[model samples]
Target: MNHGPDDLSSTGEFDSDELALRRMLQQAVQEMEPRDGTLDHLRKAVPARRARKRQAVVGMAAAALFFGTAIPAVVHVSSTGTSANTSNAGHASQTQGGAGQGKEEEGGESTSGGSAGKPEDKGKGESKDADKGKSAGASTGASSGTDPSTSTAASAAVCTAVQLGTPTATTAVPDASGTVYGTFHITNGSTAACTVSGPGIVTPAAQGAADASKISALRHVSGDVASAGLPDPSQEVAQLLLQPGSSYDVKFAWVPTETCPTSEPSTDPSPDPTTSPDASSSEGSSTGGDTGTSTQLLTEDGTTDGSVLVTNTAEGGGPSVSTTVSNACAGVVYWTGLLTSS
Candidate 1:
């Protein structure tokens, strides 16, 4: 049935030229690269991306709804359930019981609302304070400021009159200027050490009432006791440290002179006592005039009838003590200095 190419074309059948072109096209398509699974991957990825976006939108809406509605509901439940309400006593009790048990399971802390929780709250507060105390005690050494234990130890180490003993006096010969010098010795009789201060008084010895004496010295008292602390700008006082069975001396100097220094009289007018209340109140009051009395070495009555009183500076008030000495010289000027040990 082999027919010519022109006759097949005229009979409206497949031409030779069209057949060759189809064969060439098929061969070219087969030689090209094939894409495996690319379309399938794209088809899978588009729907997955759309699903994730939709899920995100749904999650945002759910979160907004929970915050706007469910959160307030939970808050109302927590507040109404845990707190007191006079209208609903039974409900409050039940809620309180549940809250207490729940709190115990959480951290052993009962809400401070009803009487049932008060005891637990008190015990927990006490436990917390005890823990704080232990931590504070552990860090005490590193803390700044005053500590009670340190202050107590320091006070215990300070010396006082409880350890001081009786003082004895001895006289020496008069110098070329007729000034009398003497030494008084104080011994520590206690089992511990002590501190003693001086510039103490020295006057004529006495017993009960003052009476005339035959001694040829003036009745004069020395200045105040030399302080064991910093007192003034011009003078420095050092206290005597007396150990057990130890002693220290205080030197005394007396000048038998006649002249005495006096304060000049003030020219201001005196105040009137008639305008005041009573006479007894005006006894020691100065009237803005020259009312200061003169100080003399000799007593007015010329008697040595007073008792000696020795006052010691100490806490808790120690033992009672006295020193007796007589000075009968007339018109004598006396001066005392800081205490010293030689």
Candidate 2:
């Protein structure tokens, strides 16, 4: 069992020489001393080194997280923009297509048939344009049709003598100037409508003491002092369409002059003395006194002295209507145009 040093080495046991060498290393380690300040330097260097390592790790993680979120966000934004552009393009195409369809319907042509230079297409286009023009013209004509109707109503046939009712006359109290103002009322007796134009012919009645020469001196005026307190005839219409049973007024002024003749006494023989006194007095009163000439008298009833006659001759001829416009002195007559009744 006792082996040599070579036998002990093969058996993994330390010999006397190895034991002595280990003892020498231990002795050297026990006697060794660090340089001054070496511990403090190591203490500070260790924590700083650890902090640098941690900062490097955190920086790497943050860079990774930022890149991860940023790349996807960029991709999403790019995709969204692309989608919006595509949608806008689609909508634009649809709008254009609809417009094309409308044009096709109106012009009776297809968008695919781009042969605009063909004779048949040109003819169709011209025909459509002509139809549009015709429609516009028809609309315009329909809108303008009201004026003719109004003009027709205004231009009714002239009233005839048979269609007119018997005209009546009225006279107002004479003014201080012996100017008599009155009105002539003309009516439409027939059922039909008719027109009366202009101030009709006016003449004095033959029954009164109206002088023919004086009556012939009638004048037409817009207005005069004799027409005061009455409606102004200047503003009245010259012509009027009268419906059945309707009436119109014509104002007249009888202005007297100083040339009228005075009354003259009758030359008849005096009544017999045997006649009763009352009868004689009546007869004498009936005849004017044989004395100086007296001024002509005009009464309200027109039987006293003078008279006037009015005839509507607008239709060539009509019945003569007479009104009492007795003027004491010889004067001119003024008549007015047609005036609507109040």
Candidate 3:
């Protein structure tokens, strides 16, 4: 039984074969170890691979940007050319429709897609022209509606003297110098329009005169007359035409208590009233018949009577109107005599 369990008939021979197998395994393990530069080569290869991937990604982005820019540019250019051709075609169609044939002669396509859009463009153009014409007509109508000269003439027509009422005198409180201002207002009372012009006449009616002839004789050549004032009635002024119920105003002034200044002889040779024949005769007659009766009129309160008669002359051969104003004396207006006018 012991021979059966450890029965190595050639035990020394098997031992030599085991030593050879162990030597072969040791040599194979040493051959299988990594080389010195293997990890360094792997690190270098990883960076190279990452750099290539980045380059590929950058190239793809650049291509996308190029295509994005180029596509819209191409579309814009194509659309611009199409619009130009369409406009030309429209113009030609309106005239003779021969531009397409000419373009075809120049190596251009006659059946282009832009040809279909020409009808719509022409419709738009016609609508625009119609709108322009409408606008022009509206502007012309607006201008014609309000003509300046016609409006001015219509507004300037005024009432004449034939339509006016008699001038009425109004007296205000006297000033410090015993001077009173008399304002005469003339109103247009008739239905007819009229114009009043000129420096009207004012005659002071002598109060308590025995006869009208004596009152006329009291009026002297050097008395109240028409004179230019603020508006300078002497200048060519536009006629003030008044409508119905319109009115105009004129001013008359006086100083009832003021005395005439005493006359003094000057260095210049002047005629003496006492030596004159007419003055001597007038003084002798006044002393004989009219001794107590004063030549110059005086009011009841001993002040000089300042009564006046105003006459308004009409324009263009129209009838004149007269008014009698009581208590209006002569006044200085702009270094001349102040009469009646507006």
- Identify the leading candidate in terms of lDDT: 2
Which stretches of candidate 3 lie above 4 Å from their native place?
A: 1-156, 165-167, 172-176, 192-242, 255-257, 260-294, 297-330, 333-342
Q: Which pairs of residues have clashing backbones in candidate 3?
A: 158-241, 159-194, 159-195, 159-241, 159-242, 160-194, 160-195, 306-328
Number of clashing residue pairs in every model? Answer: 8, 2, 8
Ranking by TM-score: 2, 3, 1
Any idea what lDDT model 1 has? 0.48
Using TM-score as the measure, the top candidate is 2
Clashes of 2: 2
* Deviation of model 1 at 95, angstroms: 64
TM-score of 2: 0.44
Candidates ranked by lDDT, best first?
A: 2, 3, 1
Q: Whose TM-score is higher: candidate 1's or candidate 2's? A: 2
Query: Whole-model lDDT, candidate 3?
Result: 0.49
lDDT of 2 by residue, 1-342 (tens): 777556767877897789668668878897789999999999999999999999999999999999999999999999999999988875565454454344453556543334323434577788999999999987555433322222223446888888876887787887776777777787778877777775577654432455666554445544555456456655677576677777777777777664344445547887688989997655535435675334345444433464555443433377456666544435666766667765
**Which of 2 and 3 is the better model by lDDT?**
2
- Model 1 clash tally? 8
For candidate 2, the per-residue lDDT at 259 reads: 38
